[model samples]
Target: MRSMLKFAFRFIKNDGHRVTAKCKAEGCPWSIHASKGSATQLISIKTMNPTHTCRGAAVSSGPQATGSWAWRGKESAQEHLQGSHKDAYSQLPSLCDRIMETNPGSLATFTTKEDSSFHRLSISFHATLSGFVQGCRPLLFLDSIPLKSKYQGTLLTATAADGDDDRQNGLQEPICEIFKGSYHGYCLRCIAEQLVRDLKGQCSQEVKRIVIEDLHHADFAPNPEDFNASVERIKKN
Candidate 1:
């Protein structure tokens, strides 16, 4: 039964003596029958209908099919390191020293357990720190995006936005700034979603039509009067 489920199949009929398994899909014709062996405790396959008519792919039951694949991978890597590279942790201090020696004025630090096992490590290059202090804006943003591996973890990052509301590069320079005259605000796509949420059953067709049409017009209105008029019309509608 467990083996059958791995191939996106399930048992439709099961008794101690015999079992009939079929595809999990609604209309698929694939099935298999198994019965207890005559002289053994094991079950033996008696018959099978191998033809599957389902359009969708079979579901996987492996670790790769799960959301924790990233975490699983991380654990596997750690186990491999422990098994095949036991000295990796012991070399951290020398690695840190080499980093600072090769890149003068850089920062490199590592902490260890009471038994001198590796605990944590951090580093920051001198050039990056100097560039941030001299050329970048003071604001900092911290964010983390999830990794999709079997062993889940986040890719943490610290970013700085430049004076022009553009992302700062590693050298503290804005990579791509928006044009000064360009408008950037609540996008029309978002506004449309909000409109649906706000006016689901309250307005007639004429009002809905006018409001949607005027939304675009209001977005590019040259004067406050036209924008205000559109707003007032929407309110009345």
Candidate 2:
């Protein structure tokens, strides 16, 4: 009976949990529900990475073969496990909050529907268009993405728009965010100005003929007037 239990524990602790095995013959089965005492804390039972689970020395519950058990200590096994988990959970949120605060451009944080719906790419396109002239032809494209919730939204994106440019072809490129709101026109104008700034940095040549598909939607209309106004404003300096 002891051998059978030992074999079962060896299989479970070694293969199932990927837990380190300091000495299988000297330890009790570390089964999830195998009981620690008056209280039982559930293990997630999810797969653990081999590096995290298998690399570390097996967690010791002290020596049972020496006629002594670490489980006899003041802290129960369940309490020990819960304490470790809480430490990890607490650290993760702190690290994430620091990252969000340090890098606003890298991530977008919005609570309400209004903030999420802000169209960032519309402003970017206007920025890029500012770099264009009558003779320089530029390429533009638009794509859409679904949100976690059910809501129709749009994302404005544009590139140097060249056939040979493989960078222009992939979905992995940095896309500007767009949100839904009443002030879309102002947002759209902002996008155009950013587009111009981006192009000027990327290519030395001026943009002449801008190519876009037919704008059945009113926003699709390539209104260079707003872009021109921004340029005139810049010249006053």
Candidate 3:
């Protein structure tokens, strides 16, 4: 098993009759558990680590086992942060000040608890904001993904598309009141998807074709009059 996986493992602990083995690398979370089967002297694996996040440098001693530069950099950063988390919290104000001083027109903001511990941090670079305001489209897309670190958190991102369909970075917050107005438009892909789902096994191919084509025309119409006319035609069809 060690040869196949190409990593060293150490016996962690024995819980009841089950024996657990974990990777020898520090900060790695990979582990496996095994237990004796019904037949005497037969050992069966109850659980195994499907994916190993530790790099080859941390797991192997052989000269040929070189890890990627990106992975090594990330591991080094994580180790530094883990060791200096308290120092980082204390230097947050100075860091924010330096960022604003180095990059004029940039925005840096953070919140802290009563004890001066870090709560949240946000930054918007001057160049990124300027590019978005000058060249990108009005539409903004917002998303958040979970961060995979010792300090668990979510990374929020905002993006936009230019006229050429290229993605540009920006920022936006969810405002329920802003979306209540008639200025908002429905997503064409979403509308088509709903149509397919609602009309599945119920409407004939001819009717579906007419409804879908009319909806597309209404959505992409050059003027409000053409849009209303296409909507009326869809209703009649």
Candidate 4:
């Protein structure tokens, strides 16, 4: 007498790279069919913590705790930004320190009481993403500007995607290498030209698009001719 039966199958595991295994059986038709066992796939993923922090990061064991606690150290965000932490200006600011130290202290410093009227435009910029992604253009956007201790009629330029869309857009932190002389056409042009060069250098000759908003009507305005000239310079670059 001949007997027949139907069989079912299912996946046991998935490792990002490939599937693993087949049904375990003794002299079963499907068992022989599993002759070609699959190898497990390995995938790298960035895990986010409940608090929205990056996970699976390797931490320094020498006098440092694991995860962000090590990087965050003992300072609060405000304190870090205000240079309150011991490492705030640990190394790179040596040049800036020398320059400021040698300069006369006659620069006009603004006080919070009198400078409340001053406004600013926030700008965020981004660079190329992948190494294989060649010739990929970089972008910039504007956000709300913050007030600072000193001002030179500072005109802030940000990425356009951010400036145009109120929604959140991923962008690299703004590189402040583009603060042109504030309030004049010539100054703006100089700033723009330098910024274009900076973008080109930073993006590995990949930045081809520029986005800017004419926010002159809202608050502290820049010189119109200079603005136009600055745009022209960027285009020429």
Candidate with top lDDT is 3
lDDT of 3 at 189: 82
Error (Å) of candidate 4 at residue 213 is: 34
lDDT-better candidate, 1 vs 4:
1
Better of 2 and 4 by lDDT: 2
Q: What ranges in model 3 sit over 4 Å off?
A: 1-83, 167-237
Tens digits of per-residue lDDT for model 2, 85-151: 3454345545546655665433333332364432332222223445333222565555666632112
Residue lDDT tens for model 1, 45-83 = 567665556732343334454324223323433333233
Select the stronger candidate by TM-score from 1 and 3.
3
- Each candidate: RMSD to true structure? 16.4, 22.9, 17.7, 24.4
The residue ranges of model 4 lying beyond 4 angstroms of the native Cα positions read: 1-47, 51-101, 114-237
Residue-level lDDT tens digits of model 3 in 1-237: 445446776777654455677878787776756665665533445675534567633544333433332234333333432434455567878888888999999998888879866788888889988878987888889999896544677899888776444621222122335555435455688889888789889878898898999999998899999999999988786
Which model is ahead, 3 or 4, in terms of lDDT?
3
lDDT of candidate 4 over 21-91, digit per residue (tens): 23333332221111112342112122212121122122222234434342332122223223342343243
Full-model lDDT for every candidate = 0.63, 0.35, 0.67, 0.33
- TM-score for every candidate vs. truth? 0.33, 0.18, 0.37, 0.15
- Ranking of candidates on TM-score, top first: 3, 1, 2, 4
Clashes of 3: 0
**Could you tell me which 10 consecutive residues in candidate 2 have the lowest summed lDDT?**
208-217
Better of 2 and 3 by lDDT: 3
Q: The CA-based lDDT of model 3 is what?
A: 0.67
